[model samples]
Target: MATQAVTNPVPVADLRRRPGRSASLRRIARKKPVGAIAAVICLLLILIAISADLLAPQGANQIDPLKNPRLLSPSLSHPFGTDNLFRDVFTRIVIGSRISLGVGFTAVFIGTVIGASLGIVSGYFRGKTDLVVSRAMEVVLGFPPLVLAIFILAIFNTSKGYSFRSFLLLSFAIGVIIAPTTARIVRGSALSIRNLQYVEAAESIGNTSFGIMRRHVLPNVVAPIIVIASIQIGNAILAEAALSFLGLGISDAYHPSWGTMLQEGRPVWLEAWWMSVIPGTAIAFAVLSFNLFGDALRDVLDPRLRQSS
Candidate 1:
C-alpha cells in the first residue's frame, strides 16, 4: 500500500513570507528606530521641495541690497540670514532642496536601470558575457568619479548652464558615475540566485534565459537593488553639490543649489558664516537621511543582514 506522506503546512495567510521580512510600516518603525527617523527626515525634505514656493517667505532670487541689509546674521526677519546680495538665505535653501533632491532621485533611477540590466544579463549568462561586463565595470571604476563626470559634462558643453536640459545633463553624468558600483553589487546578488535549485530547474524545463531571469532572478535581486539605489541617491546628491561648487553644475542665478550657495559663501565665509554653514548643513542632513534609510532597509530586507539583526 502506497501511504500518502504528510508534512507540516504553513498557514494560508502567511504564505511564502519569511518571519523577519514584514512589509508593514509599523513593523519597520518598531524593528528599526533609526530608520523611522530617517524616513521622517526624508519625507520632510520631499515636502519642503514640493512646497518651496508656498513655504518660502520670499522669492529665491528676489534681491534688494538697499532694502535688506546684506550679510545680516540670522534674525527674526531672515531665519537663515542674508547673502552678500541681500537675497533671503532661507528662501534659497528652501528652493535649493528641489534641485538637489531632484538630481539625486533622477540619477539613481538612471543608474538602477542601466546597472540592473547589465548585472542581470551578465550574471545570468556568465562565461564570455560575464567576463566582458566585469572587465568593463572594473575599467569604469578605475576612473575618479569627479573626473569621469567632468569628462562626460564637457561632451555636452554645459557651460551655458542652469536650464532644464543642463539639469538632466548633470543627473546623467552622476548616474554614469554611480552605475558601475551598482552593477558590481547587483551582479553579486544575481550570481547567487543564478545557481539556486529553482533556477536550474527552470533551465532544465527549457525556459528562455530572459524568462528565467525575469521570473526568478530579477525578483530575488530586487531587495538588494532597493538598498543599493537609495545609497546611490545620497552619493548622487554629494556629486551634484561638488560639481556646483566648482561652478560646473546648476546655475545659482536660475536655481540656488546648496553647492552654489557654498561657492558664494567661500569668499565671505570669514565675516558671513551663515551662508556656508546653512547650505552645508542641508547637504549633510540630506545625504545622512538617505544613507541611514538604505542601511536600515538592507538590515530588514537582506536575509543575511536580517539574521544578524
Candidate 2:
C-alpha cells in the first residue's frame, strides 16, 4: 500500500500584512494633543537653553541701575521689562535657561547612569547585591527630595567654597534623589526582559551573563530609561529652581537663575513683578513641556498603547 503523501502548509505573506497595517493604525491613534503640546514646549525650552547666550539681550547678571528704571513694564527695549535694580528681565530669563537646563540634564544624566547600572546588576543577579541596592534606594526614596537637597547644600556650603561647589552639590543631590525612581524603572524593565527567549538562547549558547546582559538586555531596557530620564530632566530643573528659591540651592546670588530671581523678587513682587513673572513663567513652561513631551513619548513608545490604538 502506498503511503499518503504529506505536504507542508504554504507560507502566506498576508499573515504579516494585517499586523503591519494594524501597527501603523495604532501609531496614529496613540497621538495625543497634550503629548504633542508637551513635546513642542520641551523642544522650545531646549532650543531656548541652547541659544541663551545668543538670544539674551545683555549679560544675565548685568545691572544698569540707571538706564532702565525699576519695575518698568515690557517694552521694545526690554521685552520682559527691567527688575528692581534695572536689570533686564529678558536677558536674565534667556541666560537663566542655560542654568536650569544644565542642572536638569546633568542631574538626569547622573541619575540615569547610576540607576541603570545598579538596576541592571541587581535584576540580573537577584541576590545580596539586589537586596542592598534595593534597600538603599528605598531609604533614599523615604526622604523628601527638597529636604535632602537642603541638607546636602548646607553640608557643602559649610565645608567647601560655594562657587561651582554649590552647583555641583545641587546637581548631585538632585541626581541622588531621582536615582531611586530610575533604578526601580530599570530594574522592572530588566526583570521582564531577562527571561525572554533570546536571553535563554544566549545562555544556551554559552554566552556569559554579563555579555548577555550588555548585548541583549541592556539595549532593550535602555529605551524606557531614556524616556524616563528625559521626563525627569524637567523635574530636576524644577527641583533645582525650588531649592534655589528656598535658599538651599546654588549659592551664587549673582547668578541669573529663575530660582534666584524668584527669591530676589519675593520682597519686591509688588514693586517689580516682572522679575518674578518672566522667570516664573519660564520655569513653568519648561517643566510643563518636559512633562507633556514625556507623556507623548510614552504613548509613542509604548507597544501596548500602540497595539490598543
Candidate 3:
C-alpha cells in the first residue's frame, strides 16, 4: 500500500487578519501621503504647544517695544514679526496652540463620555428608553452647533466676562452642543453590537445590562468614538476660534490666541499681513491635520471600508 501524504493546516482567521492589517497599513502609508504629512504637522504643532514656555523667548502676552518693534516683518529676532501692541507673533502662535488644543480636547472628552453613555444605554435597551433618549438627542441635534454655542456663551459670559472660568464654560457649551450627534453615532454602533451572538451569549450567562454595555458595547464602539473625537476636536477648535475672533471667546489679554490674534491684525492688513496670515495658517493647518487624520483613521478602523479598499 502507498503511504498517505498529509499537509499542515492553515490558521485561516489569523492568516486573513494579518495580511489585511498589513495591507491596510501599506495602503495608508503609500496612498494617503496627505494624511501622513498632516499627522506629522499635527505632531509638530502639539510639541510646540507643549513646549511653548521653553521655545518662546518672549512670553505670549508680554509686550516689549524694544525687542518687538511694531509692524516689523518676519526676520531672525522675531520670526513671525510683531503686532500693533509690539508683541511677538511667533510666541503668540506657540502659546495659542495650548488654548486651541486644550479647549478642543476638553470639549471632545466631555462630549464623548456623555454621548457614549447615552448611546450605549439607548441602544442596548430599546422601546421606551430608546425612544426617550433618541428624541432628546434629536432635539439637541436639531439646533445648529455654532448657534447653540453662541447662545450658551452669551448666557454665561453676560455677567462673568471672558475670564478662564468663562473659557471653560465655552468648552463645556461646545461639548454639550456636539454630544447629541456623537450619541446618535455611538447608538447606531451599539444597536448592531447589541444583537451579536457574543452579546446574546453574555446575556444568557446572566450578564447584567450595565456589564454588557460596559464590557461589550463600549469596546466595540471605540472606532466611532475615536473618529468622532478626531473630527469634533477640529470643529470645536474652529468654533472656538470663530468665537474668539468675534470678541465672544477668550478675550483675556493674558492668554494669547490665534483667533484674537486675527482680530488684532484685521485692521492693519496692509502694514503687517504676517500678523493675520501666520495665525490664520496655523488654524488652517491644525484643522486640516485633524480632518486628514480622522479620514485615515476611519479607513483603518472600519471593516467595511477596509474590505472595499
Candidate 4:
C-alpha cells in the first residue's frame, strides 16, 4: 500500500524570508525608481496623517506661554515653531492632516464612485444616454474647477462656520468639481471595454446590462481609475487648501489647515517667516508627492505604457 506523502509546513517567517512584499518592492524600485520614491513619500504622508496625535508634541491649539512664544521660528524646541497665538505650528499641521486627508479621500471617493457609475452606463449604451452624458461632462468641464467649487460651497450655505457638517458640505462641493474629469476618463476607458469578447459573452449569457458593466466593464477600466484617483486625491487636497485660503472653507480655531495657516500668516509673514514657509512647504510636499505617485502609477498601470516600457 502506498502511503500518502506528508507535507512539511513552512514557517511564516520562512515564507517572509523567501519572496514577498520586500521582493515586490525591490522589483518596483528597480523598474521605477521615481515612482518608488514617490510611493515612499506618500506612505510617509499617510502614516503621519494617521499617527498625528501621537506624533505631535503639543495640542493643536494649545497656546504656549513660553517667553516670546509667538512665531518663535523653527528650532529644537519647536520644529515648525509657534504661531501668532503661541499655538504649536507643528501640532496644528499634524492635526490639520486629519482634515486635509479626510476631505481629499472622501471627495475623491464620492467623485470616483459616482463618476465611474455614470460613465459606465453612458459608455455601455452609446445612443442618447452617451450623447447626454458626454455633453453634460463637457459642460461641467467648461467651468473652472476652483470657481465651481467656490460657487457650490457658497450655495450650500457654508457661511454657518466650519463644523463637521460644513466640512462634509465642502467635501461634497469639491467632489462635484472632481466628478466631471473622472467621468470623462472612465467613459473613454469603458468605451473600449464594450468590444471585449467577455462583454459579448456576458450579454449572450443574459447577464443584465448593469451586471455586465459592474463585473466586466468596471474591472477592465480600473487601471485608469486608480491613476485618476491618485491624481485627483492631490487635486482635492489642493482645492481644500485653496478654499481654506480664500476664507471660503475651514476656519475653526481648533482646526488648523495649511490654507488657513497661510491666510493667518499672510499678514505677519514678513515678521515671522516660518508662519508662511512651514505650512506652505507642507502643502507643496503633499501635492508633489501625490502628483509624482500618480504619474508613476500611470506609467506602471497603463497597458499601453507598460508595453512601451
Candidate 5:
C-alpha cells in the first residue's frame, strides 16, 4: 500500500514575504528621486502651513506703521519683506498656504467623489444613461473652466458677506467646474472595466449593479482619478490666484492670499519688486511641486508606464 506524503507547512513569516516586491523606502527613492524630492517639498509646505502660527513672527493682520520699514527688501527679520499695507509679506504668504492648499484639496475631493460616482453609474448602465452623462459632461467641458468658476463664485458672492462660508462657496464652485473633466476620465475607465471578464462574471453571478460598481468598478478607476486630482490641484490653485488678482476673489480683510498679495504688489511693482516677486515665487513653487509629484505618481502607479520604463 502506498502512503500519501505529508507536506511541511510554510512558515507564517515566509508566507508574508512576497518575492520581487521589496517594500523599502530606499528602493522607492532610487526609482523616482525627483518625485521623492517634490513630495518632501510638498510635505514641508504642509508643515509650514500647519505651523504658521508658530513660524510666522507676526499675525496675518499685523501692520507696520513705519513708512521706511514698509515695502522694504527681504532681510533676516522679514524674509519676504513687507507689503504696501505694511503687513508682513512672509506671514501672509505662510498663512496663505493653508487657504490655497485647502481650496485645492477640498475642491478636488468634491469633484472626484461626485464625478466618480456619476461616472460609475453612467458607464455601468450605458445606453441612455451613458448618453445623458456624456452630453452633460460635454456641455461642462465646452465652457472655459476659469470663466465658469468665476461665474459660479460671483453668483454665490452676491448677497453673502465674506466669511468661512465664502471660502466653501469658492471651493464648491471650483469643484463643480472641475467635476466634468473628472467624470469624463472616470467614465472612460469605468467603461473599460465594465467590459472585463471579472465584471461579466460578477454580472453572471447575479451581482447587483451597485455591488459590482462598489466592489469592482470603483477600484479600477481610482488610479486615474488620483492622477487627475493631483494635476487639477495645481490648476485650481492657479485659478484661485487669477481670480483674486482680477479682484473677483478673496477679500484682503478676511485672508491675504498670495493672489491678493500679487494684486496689492502690482501697483507698487516698480518701487518694491520683492512684494510681487516673493508671492509670485511662492505660487510658482507650489504649482511646480504639484505637477512634478503628479507626474512621478503617474510613472509609478501606471503599469504601462512602469513596463515601458
Candidate 6:
C-alpha cells in the first residue's frame, strides 16, 4: 500500500481576488500627459461656464455705440478687441459659455432620457417591439442632422406663430438627432447585462420584469450611458453653433451667443480678425475640452479598458 499526498484546491473566489496586469496598465494611463492635461482643461472650462457672469468684464450684449470703434484691434483695455458693433469680444466670449453649456447639457439630457428608456424596454422585451423601434431609430439616424435642422427651421420660420417657439423647436430637434445613437448604445449594454447570472437569479426569485430591470440592470448599465451623454454635450454645442451660424437658431438679435458672434464676424474676418477669432477660438476650446474629458472618463470607467490599462 502507498500513501498519496492530498492537496487543497485554490478556491475560485481567492483566485479572482488577485489584481491582474490590467490594473497596472490603468495606473499608467492615469499618469499619462494627455489624461492630465485633458482633465485640467475640462475643469477650467466648466469653471468658466459656471462663473461667466462674475468673470466677464462687461455685459455680453452691451454695445458702446458712441465710444466703441468698429474693427478695433486687441489692446490692453480690450484684450480680444471689440466687434463690429463695439461689444467687448472678451465679455461675449465669456457669456457665450453659458449659452453653449446650457444648450449642450439640456439637449444631451433630453436625448439620453428618451433614448435610454426606449433602449432598455426594447432590449429587455425584444421581438416585434425591438424590431420596430430599431427600424425607427435607423430611419432617424439616416438623416443628416444639419440638413434636417435647416429644413425644420425653414418650416418653423414660415409658420403663423414664429416667435419663442423656434428656440424650443431647435432644442427638441437637436435632441431628436442625437437620440438614436444613445438608444443604440443603451440597447447594447442592456442586452449584455440581461443574460448575466444575477439577472437570471432575480428572474428565478419572481421579481417583476420592471423591478428586475430597475434594481439589477439600470444601475449596472448607467456608467456607459453617462460617458456617452458627456461626450454628446460637445456635439450638441457644435450643432447649435452651426445652426446659429446659418441664421436658424435663436432668432433674437439681442441674444449674445458664440455662434451668432461668429456669424457677425465672418464677413470681416480678414479686416477685423479678432471679431471671428475670439468667439471661434472659444467654441473650439470648449468643444475640445468636453471631448478630452469624455475620453478620459470612458477609459476610467470601462471595465475592459480599466482592466487592460
Model 1, 29: alpha-carbon shift in Å? Answer: 1.7
Error of 5 at 261 (Å): 0.7
Candidate 4: regions farther than 4 A off: 1-21
- Tell me the tens digit of each residue's lDDT in model 2 across 73-152: 99998789987777788888877777788889989998898999889988888779889999999988899888887777
Q: Each candidate's lDDT (Cα)?
A: 0.89, 0.80, 0.84, 0.86, 0.82, 0.80
Instruction: Please write out the lDDT profile of model 1 over residues 1-309, one tens digit for every residue.
Output: 998766876787789665664457777788899988997999899999999989988888888887568999999988999989989999999999998999999999998988998999899999999999999999889999999999999898535757788888898999998998889888998898999999999999999999999999999889889999988888999999999898887766747899899889999999999999999999999999999998898898888877877
| Cα deviation of 191, candidate 1, in Å | 1.0
Over 4 Å off, model 1: 1-23
Off by over 4 Å in 6: 1-32, 65-67, 154-168, 251-253
- Give candidate 2's whole-model lDDT: 0.80
**Residue 210 shift from truth in candidate 1, angstroms:** 1.8
Off by over 4 Å in 2: 1-30, 157-165, 251-254
Q: RMSD for each model, in Å, please? A: 4.5, 5.4, 3.6, 6.0, 4.3, 5.3
RMSD of 5: 4.3
The collision pairs in model 4 are none
**What tens-digit string does per-residue lDDT give for candidate 6 at 72-175?**
79988888888877878888877777666777777898889889988888788788978998999988878898887677667766542224565567777788
With candidate 5 superimposed using the best TM-score fit, by how many Å does residue 204's alpha carbon deviate from the native?
2.7
- Each candidate's TM vs. the true structure? 0.90, 0.85, 0.88, 0.90, 0.90, 0.84
- Backbone Cα, N, C clashes tallied per candidate: 0, 0, 0, 0, 0, 3
lDDT of 3 by residue, 118-228 (tens): 998999998899999999988888888788888888887654335668767878988998898789999999999989999999999999999988898889999999988
Candidate with the greatest lDDT versus the true structure? 1
lDDT of 4 by residue, 1-309 (tens): 998866987878887875778887797689889878988999988898889889988877787586438778888888888888988888889988878878888899999987888788888998999999989988888999999888888777535555888878888889988998888888888888898898999899899998898888988888889999999998999999999899887657877788888888998978999888888888888988898999989988887888898
Count backbone clashes in candidate 4: 0
